[model samples]
Each structure stands twice: as structure tokens, then as C-alpha cells.
Target: MPTGVAIRDVREQLFDAAERVLLRDGRNALTSRAVTTEAGCAKGVLHRHFADFDAFLTDFVLDRIGRIDARTGALRGSAGTGTVADNLTAALTALFESAAVAIVGLITARDELRARLRRDLPAGVPVLTEAAELVAAYLVEERDLGRITADADVDTLAAMLIGTAHLLFADRFGTPPEAEGVRRIVTTVLVGVGPRP
Candidate 1:
């Protein structure tokens, strides 16, 4: 809206505004008008940067997924330092954050956005698949460090973690799982996979 605003700044502001609207008012309330109003910018700003509302939604959803990936990807750095349960809990918690869950709902509720994402993303897996791979990679690194049992099926463990988190996030009306709960889930799931004490 400002006369001298940078394009990147505008896009970031729009994204932030859209996220706020989606989180506060649910997926149905996310529109170019709502985003622009929240961002204090012209409605055309979204269209200027994205092809349509679906494109904007796709970018917003992908951005959230990218953030989750980056967060989980960093777990590799903490691979052997902390208890495997603690580290895995941290990654799973990051995946189920309120905003991330909200974006998941937004994308799922909009067929156009989902379709666009499928077309744009590689292998039709979207970023969630990449996130699982990142988690699996972290598990492999921990195994290499002898923190986890070498026999652990890292891919299966990663999928189980992702699937559980997805269920937790999708059930919005239920009491959300806390960090300790996540720790318990990870501990239970890793019983056979963790190194013998």
C-alpha cells in the first residue's frame, strides 16, 4: 500500500496477514479482501504477486510447510546430544503448531489450492513428504551416532510420527497433545528402535 514498499516486503506482509486471518477466522474467511484488510494494503496486492486466490493460498500453505521442514531439518544438528525421545518430540511438536495446523485445514478445504499445489510440487508428494524424509534422515543420523538401534526402520518410524502428528492436528476439537505427551508417544514408538541401555 505504501508508495515505496519493496515487492518482497509486500509479499511477506500479505502472507503474514493471510496467516492471521486464517488462524483467527478459519479457512472460509481467507480471501484477498480479508488478507489485504489485515495487512493494511490494497486488495490488488495479492493478485499482483500471485495469479489468483488459489495461487496465493498455495504459496501460503507451501510456505508453512517449508517452515516445518526447516525446523525438522535442523534436528539433525541435535541428533545425538539429547535423548532421542526429546529430540523427536521437539520435531513433532514443531509440526503440530497451531498455525501449521490451521494452514493444513485451509489447503484441504480448498480444492483449487490443493490441485494447484499438486501440480506445482514435485512427485505430487508436496512438502509434507519432504518433511517426513527430513525426519527419516535425522533418524538415520542418530542411528549412525549409535543413539538409536541400527535395526530401526527409519522410514517407517518417520511415517508413524508424521501420521500421528497429522491426526493430532486434524482433530482440532480435541485437547491438543502437549510436549510431554509427544515425548511419551516418541518413547513408546521408539521402544524397540532405541539403543539398549
Candidate 2:
């Protein structure tokens, strides 16, 4: 609130604040004021860093999407070491437990934010698309390793996995599905596409 006060990692702070607002109040309540208030920074801090509120939001979602890289490495790294269903369940749980679902909701409900993000992200839902890509990459690794069937379409399977997980975790505000519930869905979806017992 003070004039000329330096905030470290201002962009990241604003993104985190925005995510918290999205999780707490849903899509309609995310605003520049809300984010600034949550971040404990003056409203001008956001404008000083980003061109506008929508720009801030677009970058916010992209930042969240970018954060998925750690998950990708971890998920891909787990390919042959663990059961495919369990790995998927864990990935889905981590993704939704973060702001992924609420970020998707914000992306869908805001036209300006969507349009701005389209130039950079360009296809599929931003957070979901990145998640699906990683899922596809992980599946391809498994398929190559014989954990998945040779005939399986990794891309389609990835989409199905991400989509199903998204639905299972959607509309719950901040509460994620029970781990068992997520695992059950993951197991059901992986059936027949996995190696023959």
C-alpha cells in the first residue's frame, strides 16, 4: 500500500494471489482489486508490471501452465517404475489440488483473458492442454516400454485421461476428489489399453 515499495517477485505474487481468489470466490470474483488485495500490494503494482488486468490474467494462467513442467518431468520419470494407473492418479491429484481447475474455469469464463492467451497458447485449454501433452508424453514412454499396448493412441489416451480427471475434480471449489475415487477412474480408463495380464 505504500508508494514506491519494492515487492520481490511481484508477478509471481500477483499470480498466486489471483489463484487464491479464484479458488475462494470462483471465476466471477477474480479482479485486479481482489488480486492486489490478496497480494498485500497496492493496486498500481499490478499495472506497473503488466499492461492490463487481462494481460495479468493471461500471464497468470500461462504461469500456472508453465508450472506443470515439474509434474511432467516427475510423471515421465515415473513411467516404468510404478503402475500406470497409480502414476496417473497421483498426477491428476496434484494437478487439480493446485489451481488448475479454477484456472480453467477462469479461462473459460473470461473472453478477454482467453483471447489474450490464445496468441501464445493457441490450442486446447491452457492448463489442461499442457497437462494432456505431458500425459501423452508419459504414455508414449510407457507404450515404448511395453507398459502400454503397442496399438494404443497415446494422444487420444492422454486427452481422455486429462478430460476425465478434469471432470472428476471440477466444480468442487477447492476440495479434490478422494484419492481412491481418482484412482478408480484412472484404473478404469487404463484398462484394455495396458499390457495383457
Candidate 1 segments whose C-alpha is farther than 4 A from its true place:
1-8, 122-127, 173-175
lDDT of 1 at 100: 65
In candidate 1, how many clashes are counted? 0
Per-residue alpha-carbon lDDT of candidate 1 for residues 64-129, written as tens digits (9 for 90 to 100): 777777777668888878688888888878777747677767766778887888876755345557
- What is candidate 2's CA lDDT for residue 117? 87
Cα lDDT, all candidates? 0.79, 0.86
Query: Cα lDDT of model 2 overall?
Result: 0.86
Query: Per-residue lDDT of 1-197 in model 2, one digit per residue for the tens?
Result: 78867899988899899988888888889989999999999998999998999989888888888786675558988989879998988988888777888888888898988888889985988888889899999999999999989998889888988999899888664456899998998888787898966
Which runs in model 2 stand beyond 4 Å of their true positions? Answer: none
Model 2 TM-score, all chains together: 0.94
